[model samples]
Target: MSTLPAYVVFGEALTDFIRQSDGRWAAQPGGACWNVACVGVRLGVAAGYAGSVSNDLFGDALYMLAAEAGLDMRFTQRFDAPPLLAMVPSTQPPEYFFIGEGSADLRFDPDRLPVGWRSAAQILHFGCISLAREPLASKLVEVALAAHLAGKRIAFDPNWRNLMTHAAYRDTFHVMAGITDYLKVSDEDLQHLFPGINQREAIAHLRALAPFAQIMVTRGAAGMSLFCDGIEYTQPAFPVTVADTVGCGDAAMGGWMASLLRQPDAAPATHLRFAAATAALVATRTGAYAPCWEEVSSLLAQQITESPHAQ
Candidate 1:
């Protein structure tokens, strides 16, 4: 049998220091790109990650987790710096305070990208702080643009963290949007990128920016919306007990990409349903934990069985 197409995720690999309700902290290996890669590999896609991975304890933990999850680490850039750290409060809308100045993620050198890495994967996913921070931001854009020119599918998620200015992120958004084939963004991201505008206007703004890309927007509990082939498909969020929404958006992105890899010609609604279901399952757990294929399949099956359309 032919080997499955590989998916390459390029961005940050860092540790998040999540503050617990008991005034304690727990370290979790997470970065938006890393989480997306984890979700893809966990969902049965052959995936690899390319980013600056430090040689510190947190970095070691991130590497082990990725390796255990079966992610390809051949493209990861090893650095002597420490891993980036984010202090996240346990709240409904999680807030972040970054403690990474000269962290490995920020110091990523795009020129050192693995030879033939661009053609090694069918799809290249990029986003998060790697596109929001300096030096690396430009480097990542250069890499993404190069990959696009090489005819590889490009996926992007604006993520829109608090660490970067709205203007900075907006600028990066435009740059990536031009080359992105698939765009996964959040309602909050739209609000930050195009503030004082209604949902219609916000979407219009995105359309104007990336008219060719299939755009997916996650709207918290309301669910998700997709703009593809000049048509709009909306899916309501799956009802699940919320633990925290820290990784819900990334999970949605991962699920959408996984579906694309498994079923490239699936309908927009079908993709939206799968992605929304994946996000709902992820929201049931804390942190950016990647759900296995069985977990997502079980939830999707239950949804189909419970839906009135099925009857």
Candidate 2:
């Protein structure tokens, strides 16, 4: 607990206002990077979110939740700027707009991070709209690039959004994807990232972009596919009643990374199954729910008990 966390996730921490089917809006503590970090921590990983948030109640909630989840609070910063917000007016792809003209996420200063964070962490994660904004985006890119150059593991997930269609964001995406050691993208993201291209071509492009990286593509309820070591591995999604798909991808990424770090030499198939189960648990709950390690293991064990050969 005295040392830095092994997992460091950098990006925005915002409140999501998802409109419900009943014509009402629900507020949830969400943001791709923030949720991923919290998921790792809750999944029994030494993780922390390396970002800044407003010092108001919204950020206060995020801060308190992360702290209670056992994230080392030394890496997160607080600013007096307005809190960032995501207004999701629709579902299926989670269409939303940002309200961060001067949000605290924009004020994240890498210079203020703990002195030894760069060398201490095992993996540094970045993605989502965090790479869409300026100043902070460029700074995050620099941080990621530096981490890669130093031989530290770097994980990236484009986490597509409407704002990512910008020409500028395209350049940023390629830069991050190219340097990342681990790249995680969803089926929806592939369509947005490589418009007019087929899945095979898009994946080929990603392989060319990050030749040495282990790439993972999530296929919603269908399951997930992985391309690693010049081979392909697939894992089926665990059957679970649907609640909402929000944060499912983050759960997968967090679960994958947690298993990778915790299990060390576990097979890629086992890791994928672990991740799929972690995400499945989250889909049974609303918001960016962080499933604990016990719940995930229980689900996996129950699956084995129910159908020994299915897994």
Instruction: Identify the candidate with maximal TM-score.
Output: 2
The parts of candidate 2 lying over 4 Å away from their true place are: 304-311
The per-model lDDT (C-alpha) reads 0.83, 0.89
- Score residue 72 of candidate 2 by CA lDDT: 86
| Model 1 weakest lDDT span, ten residues long | 302-311
TM-score of 2: 0.95
lDDT of 2 at 74: 91
The most accurate candidate by lDDT is 2
Q: For residue 273, what is the lDDT in candidate 1? A: 83
TM-scores, each model vs. reference: 0.93, 0.95
Model 1 segments beyond 4 Å from truth?
A: 1-5, 166-168, 305-311
User: Per-residue CA lDDT of candidate 2, range 48-113, in tens?
Assistant: 899999999999998998899889899899999999999989876557798999889989999998
